[model samples]
Target chain A: MTFQVILVLFALFAITRTSRQYRKRKVSLYWFLLWTGLWALVIGIALYPTTADAIARFVGVERGADLALYLAVVLLAYLVFRLFVRQEETERSITQVVRQIAVQHPSKPDETH
Target chain B: MKTIALIPAYNEESRIAASVRDARSFVDGVVVVDDCSVDRTGEVARAAGAIVLRHVINRGQGAALQTATEYALDALNADALVHFDADGQMVAREIPMMLEPILSGEADVVLGSRFLGRATNMPFTRRMANRLARLFTLAISGIALTDTHNGFRALSRKAARELTVTLDRMAHASQILDLVKVRRLRYVERPVTITYSEETLAKSPSSFRAFGIVKDILKDKFFTRI
Candidate 1:
């Protein structure tokens, strides 16, 4: 019962945070949908643990908890890789913009003329 | 042809003024790209009669050089472009030697080779590192240049406008050689002297710089999309 309550609270928190980000235009609808689906699936599994065991057995996993842990680790690694690639792209764009600004306004003493 | 010297500077306020003054005597105009220097490099360069362009953020030497090249071609309308360092290591006397081929229409690009000429006070480790860099560049780009990292160079306006330097670091030197190969630009190697000062050596450490260059080249070759 405590586990189900904790999962319910987490689902609410995640939904609230994602909606805020969506309203701020920080995340797209596709990402919003994806996060919602993940949280919903987690809440469903937490409420009905036996259903997860059946699905886990179908996927050749001995335990539902192990399956959840594995999927969580894989998702976290993929998200980290995406973040790294995005950061590199942002840095490259910043360099390009900085170069253009530097060239456009030369700090010459005779620029007043 | 109206020639302009482009100096890519990063925090060499002590040496930039002298470099600008020395280069001013030979070239028609000297343009220095202050690469977000913490010191008063832009003011010193401008006071020494050099057109100064200040980067908003600290991009590396390659970005600074690219900015100066574009300004020389687009704003200054320079017929010929010369790339010189602001560390006060290169000599002004050799400018004419690098420029002669470009002026006589013999080559579109002129690269200075320290091995072909003279190097005073150049450290032994730097010499060995340069030899390794030569082999590395030849193996990657298939062009065996004696001094692959020399900053003193002369480029015609067409060549300067044609070649693109996207890397914001030391790897752009190898990228320039890649451009030379891909564009089929008429290039000649000229003998020019490089005197390494204690300050210049401190700013540019050979072993650390070699590792960074190799990493950047691999990233550009394998990781970068274009």
Candidate 2:
């Protein structure tokens, strides 16, 4: 019962944060809705454990916890891939800026050491 | 034609001066892109009569080459550009030979082929590694050539302006081949000698880094829009 209470509280806190981000224009409406829905689903599952069991059984998984773990792993992997792609784009942009600076103000050939 | 030799140098103070001097002999002008070297590479290259372009931060050899190409083509108004290495592995005397195809209007780009001429003092492991890299490049780019990664190359003004090196590292060599094929640029390979010293040999990328190049190329090929 204590664990359920903690999980519900955590989900509520996450929903509140997501709403605040949406209000501050930090997150898009689509993202805010998606996150709020995710937390709401989490709260629902925490409040009613049998819902997870029903969904897990429909998905051919034996345990609700195992289904959550699988989804978390897949989601984390996708996020990691997105971060890697973003990093590469950032590095390319940095190189472009550096190249522009280097080309614009080249050192004169006659400049002595 | 106003041929400018472009040398991409890092922390190569000891060899930059000599490389600049040698390359200066063959081309109308020498431009060295010092990729934020910690040593006195930029000063030495400038002293040796190369128009020095200093990167505020170390981008990489490929990025440096792109910078040099832009400067040579735009600022210097060069008719042709030669890509030379600062490590003294590539022979500066072969600049004209590489430029011949471009000068004669036979090809837009001319690549140096060490396999056709000689890679003197090349270690056995390095030779094997280069051979594997050659095969891998052929597989990826679908353009077969004797040497895929030789730094010695000459490009006409049009080719220099058109072919962009976006990879920004050793993978840029392979990316160049891919561009050559995709752009349908006329390219020819010329025999050029490479004299590898102990320092240059030590500076060569490890076999493990080959995997990184492969990964980068694959990502560029599929994940990114060219």
Docking class of 2: medium
Give candidate 2's fnat, 2 decimals: 0.84
**After superposition, which runs of candidate 2 have C-alpha atoms over 4 Å from their true positions?**
A111-113
- Model 2 earns a TM-score of 0.94
lDDT of 1 by residue, B1-226 (tens): 9999999988889999999999988999999999889998888899989989889899898888988999999999999999998988899878888999999999999999999998887788888888899999999988878999998899999999888888788888999998998899999999889887777887875667789888888877865663
Instruction: List residue ranges in candidate 1 displaced over 4 A.
Output: A1-12, A23-25, A43-81, A107-113
TM-score of each: 0.85, 0.94
Native-to-model Cα distance after best TM-score fit, residue B100 in candidate 2, in Å: 0.5
- What are the chain A TM-scores of the candidates, in order? 0.84, 0.93
Residue lDDT tens for model 2, B72-99? 9889999999999898888888888899
Error of 2 at B208 (Å): 2.7
Each model's DockQ score: 0.55, 0.80
